[model samples]
Target: MIAVSDNLPAGARQPTESGDCIDENDARQAANWVAETLERLSRSSFRSSFTLSPHDAEYARRKGRELIDRHAHEMLAQRVGAAQPAKDGRQTPWRGHPVFTAQHATACCCRGCIEKWHHIPRGRELSAQEINQLAGLIMAWIDRDLAAHPAVTGERDGWAAPPENPKDAGAEQGGATPQPRRRSDAAGHLERSRRHPDNHHADGASGFIQGELL
Candidate 1:
């Protein structure tokens, strides 16, 4: 990933209250919003033209972050007319993450399918709660911007978000999976199960926001 400091023009120091990461949370929220917006863009017949296989999703998931690293480097310059930082030291850039386009390209195929898609990068230590949180953030974002989601509203009006993987969609279509499943109880649900993938994100942008707030 690009060094947070590099994002500033030469001589830009950390904000007096908060340094280089000033816009980091804003970056995460905007990136996710952009991602949901990407999903709504999927109605193109070209979508069918390019269905991504899980293997490909795996490949992208494996390589995407490295790509994020490179793009982050490219994004190091000044905010392209972003809003000023918040009073509490929050930075919210208007342009969103440069990787949003790239992320969308990858997400088109991976939509609702892979649980692994939610996995933290290979070297990170993530908890289940974190992964769910990120997933929630991703979904919550979609809820807010349903109208803003291009795939859903633009030329691809019929385009619905796809399952993250082909197999999952296939199971649903073919009825291979059981139609009915047990309703999960809240509170104890997470407690009884093994760790969830999103716990990482709870540690991720989602968690950072809640945890730091708490």
Candidate 2:
């Protein structure tokens, strides 16, 4: 979406010459690349701020990894993966789903971010292998977040279960029900990043690194 200059950072890893198609060796290399990339991304306060809410974690768990993987493919193909997407930089939302959060956290939300962070080039449609690799990266982030905050079982503090039939239960017994914790949006951080260019690499302790998958 946003077409920032494609100037790679100093000491940045070079993009592979294998084009868009990734081979077995590429996959192995990609694993290491993803680890290093995520670490660098975690240094940015804006990028590390995105995390899945309990509801999102529950949804991912209920849907299973297979469905989540499918969603990754569908989302990548529809929202990204194209040479030039419909909205480009603004195509991805900041919240509403785990995958969306993962995209932001992992820098897979747009073409510019993808190229800047993952060494993936722009101006051409992403290959199936490339899409898959990106999807894998997204899933890896989601999995880590889910694992970091295990599902809260039983009744949470200050949360009360609602009656099956509120009307039948009568107004006397009805009481206020606590809402689920909402996932935080990084819009403020994004804006800060825009105003303060140096904010992109601001020093911050990221929880993701500790829970990163091997």
Candidate 3:
């Protein structure tokens, strides 16, 4: 993981007063809206539709923070001049985080989605003002999920630890095998849950915004 810079450039702090970042009250309001939407969706036949899998939720909570901290400035602050595809064909800009899945699921994954869902236009690069606002919006969605499901995530165990020896995997003396926690390392790039593999598809420049102001 790239080391996150502690210093944000000028005008990069989360909004406090009625500008970029959503204050506590604003976050609460946004969370409430999402909760309500979820509640309504839960009542429908597609009750299981919107919720992330437990494994996916855990991965998102952990890696989303890492991805945001490591790359949000380059993603949201600067201009995306062209689509840059990695070796595997996933666009470099938006790959590697379940947050993009959340963004796609939440209609915040690309500039087109931003335009379609939030009335933000394309063509021009987002200003730092807009960048912080959108970043806060994505964060608010993540915060709401974590707030609702606290047990799903906690401090991550070391990702770099070596695997247990195969001979020891079966346990020297075992009556019944314990169900192990699902864990995964993505070709050494990211550690995630094996049950829920990383959804690394980029949303391109579709959603540069996330969540709607209430």
Instruction: Please name the candidate that would achieve the greatest lDDT relative to the true structure.
Output: 2
lDDT of each: 0.29, 0.63, 0.41
- Predicted candidate 3 versus true structure: per-residue lDDT over 71-173, tens digit per residue: 4444444322123212222222222343443443444454554555456676666655555455555555555555566652234332122223354334321
TM-score of 3: 0.42
| Per-residue alpha-carbon lDDT of candidate 1 for residues 105-138, written as tens digits (9 for 90 to 100) | 2221121211223333333322333332343333
The residue-by-residue lDDT of candidate 2 on 1-214, one tens digit each, is: 9876677555444443233434456657778877877778777776776676555555566556766777877788888889988877767765556687788788887777777677789899988778877888898788777767766543222122122333323311112223265534545644542343232222332323235311
Which has the better lDDT: candidate 1, or candidate 3?
A: 3
Estimate candidate 2's alpha-carbon lDDT, on a 0 to 1 scale.
0.63
Q: What TM-score against the true fold does each predicted structure earn?
A: 0.21, 0.62, 0.42
List candidate 3 stretches off by more than 4 Å. Answer: 1-50, 53-56, 60-74, 77-96, 152-214
Off by over 4 Å in 1: 1-20, 47-49, 53-64, 67-214
Per-prediction count of colliding residue pairs?
Answer: 26, 3, 8
Which candidate, 1 or 3, would have the higher TM-score against the true structure? 3
